[model samples]
Target: MAQVQVQEDPDREERITMEAIVDAYGSEEQAMGWYYYLDDKITFPFQAKCIQARKVSPLKLGEVVEVTAMAPADDCEREMFVLIRWVDRELAVPLVQLEGIDVDDETEEAIADWHYWMARGYELG
Candidate 1:
């Protein structure tokens, strides 16, 4: 992907506001356009939903997270709540990258609930 040059925000050093990001979003619809762009890039069993973070915290790998979603797949279009399991980072990794390899339906459902997997983390053995 080609890098786009952007001017830094005045108030925050490394962080940029949503308005600024929207401004850079081009002429696309402001509401749900971001999710559409992501949905095009990544194929999921269902559509992707844009989850606005109430609090921004770095996500951990190998952790199960429940993401409310819409269908991005060709066959499916109905909005549904989807849970995803994240994989841990490997030896050499970078910031903001989660090593998640999408799994089959059975495994995907099993991962949606983290509490059950906490004790069975070694069950794969």
Candidate 2:
């Protein structure tokens, strides 16, 4: 975590910690921890806006989408992804790429926790 950019947030620190990462070891376990952490926290059908663009994702910056669910656990083994509604289809996009809007506090905090991990150069796989 040498590249971590420090910004104080006790809530974020508390929410995204080793404890949430129940038992097991290695990167796979860590991935599963985050998968369930997000799954249990984020409410479905929340609205989000693409805050950043990625080459592998079709989402454009500032595009708004309805986040329906977490992507398959296996698909999120490396980085987290969420299923979002797109033109007549649902697409899985990186969780870090979106910012929640009109979402509950838990969902907002969960996304921020993922962003916090990403900002620190953390990856499960």
lDDT of each: 0.28, 0.87
Leading candidate by lDDT:
2
For model 2, residues 13-54, the per-residue Cα lDDT tens digits are 665775456673788998999999999989998999999999
TM-score (C-alpha, index-matched) for candidate 2:
0.90
Candidate whose TM-score is highest: 2
Cα-based RMSD of candidate 1: 16.8
Clashes of each: 6, 0
lDDT of 2 at 123: 68
Ten-residue region with minimum lDDT total, candidate 2: 15-24
Task: Assess the local accuracy of residue 113 in candidate 2 as a C-alpha lDDT between 0 and 100.
Answer: 87
The regions of model 2 sitting more than 4 angstroms off are: 8-11
- Model 2 RMSD vs true structure: 1.8
